[model samples]
Target: MRPGVSLRTKIYGLVITIAVIAFACSLWLSIDNTRTYLNEQMQSHAQDTATSLGLSISPYMDGNSPMVVETMVAAIFDSGYYLSMVLTDADGRELLTLENPVEIDGVPAWFIRYFPIQAPTQLTDINNGWQMTGQLAVTSNPGSSHDKLWRNARNNGYLSVFIGGVALALAHLILSSVLLPLHQLEQQAMAVTHKQFATITPLPSTRELNTVTQAMNSMVTNLQTSFTQMAMHAEKLSSDAFIDPLTKLGNRRAFENQFIAQVGEMQDNDLATLGLIQLPSLQVINAKLGYEAGNGYIRQASEVISQALAHRTSGTLYRTGGSCFFFKVASAGATVEELCNHLHEQFSALYSSHYSEGFANIIATSYDNKQQLNPLVSQLDNLLTRESSTTGTGLVYWAPEQESQLQHANGLHQWGEIIDDLLASNQVTFMFQPVLACEGNQTSENVLYFELFSQFLQDGIPLANSELYAMAELLNKSLELDKMLLQQLLTIGDFKRDVTVALNITHQTVHSAEFGEWLEEFYQHNASNLPTLVLEISETAILASIDSSIRFIQQVKACGIQVCIERFGSSFTSFKYLRGLDVDYLKIDGSYISDLDENPGNTHVIQAASQVGHGVGVKVLATHVENETSLRLLEELACDGVQGNFIQPTKKLAPYSEKKQCQYWPI
Candidate 1:
C-alpha cells in the first residue's frame, strides 16, 4: 500500500513481483514469438499445399470427375502438413473433402490450450471462364510449437527460485558474523564488573572488538595488583594490633581471648589437670643483666616454654607480663599427682642445664579435683612466700601441710593479706646444704651447694611448701613465683666460691624466652666470677614434656652448665627416658636410700641404679644418708656423692668462710 516500506519486506515483495512480472513477460514474449513463427510456417505450408493440389486437380475439374477431385484432396492431406482440406464447385456445393489430425507427445492439454498457435487457412476459387467457381481450405497441426513454449517457461521459473534461495542464506550468515564479537565482549565486561578477573578470549576480525578486549585485560591486571597490595596492608595492621612486638607472642588481650576459648574446650571435654609455673626471680635477673639482656632472655624463654607446651593436650601458653608466662593443661584423665609429676619431669629436663641457679626455685602447683582455681592459687602464693624466705632453692607443691596451715588461718582475707606481705617483702629464709664428692671421707672438690627449704614471716614460722605451691597454681602465677624466688636468692645470697648450685625448674619457667635470655647473659657475665652451676630437675618433671626438656637441656649444656635428674626412680618407671637425657648426675630418691642396710631389696635397687648411671657416664648421688650404715652401703654400691643429716648439719651463710670443710654431723 505504501510507496516506501521496510527494506526487508519491500525486498521480498519486490522480488516476488519482479519474478512474477518477468515470468509473465517471458511467457507472453515466448508464446507470441513462437506462435507467430509457427503460424507463419503453417500458413505457408498450407498455401503451398493448396496451390499444388488445385493445380493438380485442375485436369480433373475440367473432366468433371469426382474421383479426380477426391484423389487430389487426399494427396494434399497425406503430405502430413495439413489437418483438413476441401475442394468445391462454384454452385456452393462440396465436390471433394479430406481431413487429417496430428497427435503431439509429452505435452499437457491445459498447457497447449493456454498457449495455442493458430495456423492460417488457405482459400482458392476455381473458375471455368474467369468467373466465380469453388473454394479450397487447408489447415495444419501446431501441437509441437505449443509444447516447446510451455517447456521453456517452466525452466526459466525454476532458475529464478534457485538464485533467490541462495541469496537469502548467504545474507543470514554474513549478519551473524558481524554481531557475534559484540555478544562476546558484552559477556566479558559483565564478568569483570563482578570482580571475576577473567581473561578475554580472542575475538573475530572486527577492529572495535579487538580494542575493547585489550582495554578490559589491562584493567583486570591492575585491579588484581591493587587487591594484592590491600591484602598485605591488612595483614600488617592485624599483626601490629594483636601480637607482642618484643617476643612476637600473643599480647595480653589476645592471650586472654585464646585462654577463654581453650578453657571452654577443656571444660567441655571434662579434663582435670591444671598447673601453673612461676618465674620468681625475673626482676633480679633483669636488674643484674641489662634490659636488653632481660628481653632477650624473656624471648628465648618464651620460645622454649612454647616448645615445651607444644605437645600439651589442649593447652596454650601466654606471655602474661614482662617476666610472667601462664599455661593450662587438662590431664585428659590423669590423676592430680600424676599430672604434676609429669609437668615436673618435662619442665625439669628443659631448664635443668640452662640457668642452674635461676631455675632451682621454679615452683609448680597441682590441684586435685576437689580444689577450685581461686583457693589453689592462694595456696601457691603462700608457699612461694615461705620458699622465698629461705634462699629460693626448692620447688613446692600443694600438699596436706599447706591445707592444714590454711585451715589454721583466721580467714581467707587474712591469709591473702599475710601472703601478699610475704610476697612483697623478703620475709622468708633459705638453708643451703652442701653436695660433697664421693671419692673419700675428705672433700674432693669444694662444690658449695644448698637445697632450698621454706620458712615464713621472721624465718621461724613454717609454711607448707605444698599449700604455697597450690595457691600459686590457683592464681595462675607460677611463673611469677618462680621468678620472684630466683630473684630473692640472687639478691640476698652470696656466691663467691667454686660451687655447683642446683635449683629446681617448673614447666612455665623452662619455656620462657625471658628466662633463657637472662641465663645466657648471666653465664656470659659470670663466666669468671661464678662457680660451675648444676641444675637439678625432678624425674616427674622431665617426663611431662620430654622433647622440650631435651632441647632446653641441650641449649643450656652448650652454655657450659651442668644438668642433673633428682628424685630419680621415685615416680612411675622412667628408666627408659633417663637414657635419652643428657645429664651430669642422677640423685637417688631418699625413700630408696633411707634404710639401705636393713632392706636387701633397697640395696639391690640402689646397686642396679648405680650400675645404670655409671654405664651412661652419670654420677649417682644418694639422698637422706642419716646413719653410718646407710653411708657405708652407698659407698659399697659405688655411689658418687652423698647428702644427708649424717653427712653435715645446715649452717649459717656467714660461717662458711670460717668453716671451709664440713665434717659428718650427728642427727
Candidate 2:
C-alpha cells in the first residue's frame, strides 16, 4: 500500500535481499575455514622444527658441544616457517638460541587485525647420558597465514559480486517478460472504464498467466458486445416516448416537448407562425359514411399536409383536433405563403370537384416572439368562428393586419446573437425518449439506446430540436449547429452506463464538407471514448444526393461512427436510396407507423420497406407506435424495432457529467 512502489520494484528488492544474505553466509564460512587451516599448518610446522632441533641438540648435549647445537638451531631457524628456535644443556643452561623478526609485506595492519592468524608454538626436552637437558622451543610465523587468508577473501568477494550482478540481471529480464501481459490487461481494463473496448494480444509462456490473459481478452469482447446492444435498445426506447401515434405527427405532448425546446432561442425580433385547417363537415361525414370512411379521409389529408410541408424550409404538421390540422412555423425571412398556396389549390380541387360535402378553410397568422401561446390560439379561434358564419366550402384567410409583420430567417446577422449565445454558454440539453422493440422485451429497463432531440436554452426557455434545427438550416448554419451539438455531447461523455449514442444530424451537416472535417476531428480527439457514436440523417436529404451522402456517410463510418437514415420511406424511391447508400438503421416515416395494423395500404408499404431494409442489412424501426395492435402488426412484418407512445414517453435524465463511469474490472 505504500506510494511510489510497483510490483517489479518489490520483486527486484526481494531478489537482491536474498542474494545478499546467502553471500554473507558463504563469505563468513570461507574466511573461517581458511583461518582454521592456516592455524593448524602453523602448529604443525613449529612442532616439526622443535622436534628436529631437540634431537640434534640431544646429541650435542651428550657430547657437551654447545657450538654444534647452536649451529644446528641457526640452520633450522633460517627457514621462513620458523620465527624463533631455542636449545639448552641438561642443567637448563642455554646452549643455543636463534630469533628472527617476521614481517609480511603488502598486508595492511587492519586486514591482519580483522582477519588474525595466531602464531603456534611447540616445545621439546633434550636428554643425554642420564642427564636432564634444557627444553627447546620453536615459534611459527603467522604473516604467511594472514596473507593467504587475505588473498582468499579478496577472490571470494569478487566472485560473489560477479554472481550477484548476473543473477539480478537475469531475474529482471524474466520478471519483466512475465508481467508484460498483465500490464496490458490493466490498460485494457482502464479503457473499458471509460466505455472504450480494445483487444489485447499476449502469448505467455507460463500456463497460469496465459490462461489469465485469454480470459481477460474474452471478458473485454463480451463487455463490448453487451454495451453495443444496450445502447441500441435504449435508443429505441427513447425515440418511442414522444412521437404521436395517429397522424404520424408529433402528438400534443410531442409538440409541447418541441415547443419547450425552441423557447430558448426565442428573441424579441423572432416570429411564431401558427395556422389551422378546419373541416367542419368531417364529423357529419363520419356520422353518415361511417367512422371508418372519416378516418380514411383524415389519414389521407394528414399525409398530404406532411408532404406539402416537407419541402419547406422548416415546419411541423400537427393534428390538433378531430377535424383540424395545424402548422407551427418560426422563421425570420417570410411567412409560409407558398405552403398556403399549395393548401388552397389542394382544398379548392377537393371542393370544386365535389369530392365531398365537407367544406375546408385555412387560416394563418404570425405573432411577435414576446406574445404568449394562449392569446395566439384565442385569436385563431375567433377567426375560425368568422369562417364558420361566412364561408361554407374552400376558403383561405390570413390575419389582415399581422401578415406585414412576418419575418423570415433572412441573414446571419439577424440570428448571430442567439446562435452565438447558445454556442458560448452551451445552454442546451437533449430530451431523450425510449424506442422499444416490438418483437423483443418491451421494458424500458432493457433499452440501451435512446434517440435524442436537442433543445437550446434561451431566456429561461428551452427551444426544441425542430425550431433550433429548422432555423439553423434556414440560415445555412446547420453545419455549425451540428458541430456545436457534437462538441456539447462529447462533454457529456457517459450515457446510460456504457451505452451507444445515436445522434441526429441536420440536412445541412450531411451535405457540408466543413461538418465532415469537423466530425472527423471530433472522433479522432474522442477516440478513447469509443463512444459508439451513431450519426442519423433523414431520408429526405439522402434521397436528393444519394451518391454524395453515401460517400459522406462512408467517410464518417470509416471514422468509426455508425450511420442511419431517419424518417425513411418519405419517397417510394426507398428502393433507390437503399440500393446505393450504406446505412445501419432505417427509421420508417411515422405516418406509416400510425394504425399500421388497421390500414392495409400502410401495412403493404411497411412490409416492403422492412424487406428492403433487411435485404441491405439495415434495421427497420417503426416510429410513433401508439397501440399494442400496431406494434404486433409491425412485429409480424419483421420490424427490427418499434418506437412510439405505446412503449414509453420522452423523459429528462441526469446529465452525463454527474454520473459515474462504468467499472467492469475483474476482482
Candidate 3:
C-alpha cells in the first residue's frame, strides 16, 4: 500500500491552487479593461487638442505668421499633456515641431513593460478659408495612462488577495469540520488494536461519514460484548470452582487448597487463626422440620458468620461439611474475641427464636505457620465434640494453648510497637521471588521479573507483610511504611540494569494521594537508578477503591512504571474491571494454581483467566506453582509466567549484578 495524504491537506491544497489561479485571472481582466479605457480617453484628449489647434492655426496659415502657429503649438506642448506637436505649410515645406520624451512616474519599469499602454496620436488639417495647409498632428503622453492602469491593477490585486485569503481560511475550517469525525474513527480503530473498544460521539453530518461511523460503532460494540461474555464466563468458572453453592462461601476443597498455599507463602511471624462452627442437630432438624428448614438454618449460620467477619482483611470462610462451617484469618486476639462474642450472641438469638432442642457449638484456635492442618482440625474437632456433648446454646470456646504465647503473639499494642520500631530503625527488607515465563517444553533460565515482598525484622526474625500492614493500618502508619519500603527499594543501585521488580501495595497506599505524589516525585529523581518497576495492586484492593486504583495506575504509568493486578481470581467480581484498568500483568492467585493438575475444574478457571488476560494484552502469571504437574498444567494452559517454590523459593533480595541467575534456574 502507498502512503496516502490526509483528506484535509489535499482539500486545502486544491482550494488554494484554484483560488490563486482565479485571483490571477480576475486581476488580469480588470487591469486589461482599465488599460483599454484609459487609452481611449488619452486618444480623445489628443484628438480634441489637435482639432482645436488646427482650427485656430488654420486662419494664420497663409504662408506667413509662422511664429503665431509655432507659439500656439508650443503653448499646448508646454502644458506637458502632449508628447509632440508639429505644423506644416500647404506645399509640405519645413514645419515647426514640438516634442518631449515620454517618462512615467510612480510605477515600476517591470509593471510598465508587462502592461504596456498605447499612446494614440491624432492628426487634423489646418485650412485657410477652404485652402487646406499641411496637417496638425498631436500625440498624448502615456505616463498618466500608465500610472492609472498600474494603480487600478494594484488595488484590484490587493482586494482579490484579501478575498482569496478569507476564502482559503473558510475552506480550511470547513475541511477540518468535515474530517473531524474521521479522525475520531481513526482513533477508535487504533484503540481496538490495543484491545480497547470505544464509540465516537456527535457523528459527522456528512451522510457517508455518518454511515461509516455507525458501522465502526457497531463493530466496536460487538467486540466489547464478546469480550464481556468471555470475561463473565471466566469469572463464572472461577466462582464455580472455589465457591460452595449452599452458602456462597469457599468449599472444603478451596479452603484446603488455599490453606496449603497460604502456609507456604506466609512469613514465619504471621499468625493464623482458625474457627469451626457446627450445627449439632442439623440432621435432627432435617428429620423433624424437613430438609428445607435444615438448609435455611445452614444459610442463617453462614450469614451470621459472614457478618461477624465484616471489615476484616485476609479472612476466608468455607463450608467444609454439611454441618461444619470453618474460617481462617490473619487477625489479632481482639478480632478473634470479637468474632466469638458476635457469634455467641447471634447463635443464642437463633436458638431462642427458632429451635427448642438444638444448639450451635463454636471452637477456635490460633497458631503460626508451623502448625499442620490435620492436627489443627483434629484439635478443633475434639474441642467442638466435647462442647457439643454438654453446653449452653451457642457456647464460645477456645482450644487450650500457652497463654503467654497467644498474648505475646496476638497483642495489637505489641505489634504496633514492633512496627513503629521497625520503621524507626529502617529495619525493612525484601524477598525477591523470580517469575519465569512459560516456554512450553523448552526450559529457559531467564526470569521475567521478581516480585518484592516486604519483610520487617523483629529480633532477627522476618515479620510477614500481612502482620506489618495490619499493624501499620491500625497505627495509621500505612503511608509511612509504604514510602519507606519504596525508598529503600529505589536506593538499591543494583536495580539500575536489566532487573525488573514488582512491589505489592496495600489498599490504603493505593488510595493515598500523598503516597501517589511522593512516589511520582521520588521516581522522577531516581528513575535512572531504578529497575523496571511494577506496582502490584491486589484484586481486592482495586475492588475496594476502584476509582482511586484506576487513577493511581494511570498516574504511576505516566511516570513510566508498569502495574499488575495481583491475586486475580481470588475475587469473584466481573472481569469488566480489567477493561478500565491499564495493567501490564495479572497474577492469578496461588490457590487456583496449587495442585492444579489434580483439580480438573481449576483448569477451566485458569484457562478462562488466561483468555481474559491475554485478550486485553495482559500477561497471565500463575503464583504458587509448586510441582512439575502444576507447572506442566500451567504451560499447557498457555499461561504467560509462573512463580513459586518449584521455580524459586523467596530469597533475600540481592543485586542482580552479583547473581545473574538464582540457584533455582537450571544451568
Best by TM-score: 3
The TM-scores, one per candidate, come to 0.37, 0.45, 0.74
Say which prediction, candidate 2 or candidate 3, comes out ahead on TM-score: 3
What ranges in model 1 sit over 4 Å off? 1-423, 440-448, 454-462, 492-496, 511-514, 525-529, 652-667
| True lDDT of residue 160, candidate 2 | 91
lDDT-sorted candidate list, best first: 3, 2, 1
The digit string of per-residue lDDT tens for model 2 on 83-109 reads 777665556676666777878888888
Ranking by TM-score: 3, 2, 1
Residue 575's lDDT within candidate 2 is 50
Question: How many clashes does the backbone of model 3 have?
Answer: 0
Cα lDDT tens digits, model 3, 1-667, are 2158876678778888899889988988998899889989999999999998888888778767878878887887899988888776777665988888988989999999889987799988877776787898788999888888888888888899888888888877888888799889978986775467999988889999999999999999988887898898997886777778888888887888878777777676666678888887788888999999999989988887887775565666789779999888665455566677778777767775456555576877766768788998998897777767755344454634542353334566777777778778888777788888777634357678888888777777666566567656656777788788878875566553577888888778888888878888998998887778888888888987778888898788878888888889776667888886778899998888877767756888888989898877889999888888888888888988889888888777765445654674211
Residue 443 lDDT (model 2): 28
lDDT of 2: 0.67
**Most accurate candidate by lDDT:** 3
Candidate 3, overall lDDT? 0.79
Query: Mind giving the per-residue lDDT tens digits that candidate 1 earns over 1-667?
Result: 2245544555557656766677678767866776677778878887887777676666557646877678667765776666777777777677766776667678777877777777568886665566555677777766555566667666655765576567656754765575566556656565543233556666577787678767777876665555444434433443444356776665554454333333322211133333455554466666787778667767766776666555442344556567666555443221334444555565456554334345323345533334555565566656666765766545444445332333233233444555676678766655556676777533344433555544455244555443344444444444565656555555544565554566666556555557666777866765665445677776756776777777777667767888888867643242556544678888876756665555545566677667666655678888777778888888877888888767775544444445555552111
lDDT of each: 0.59, 0.67, 0.79
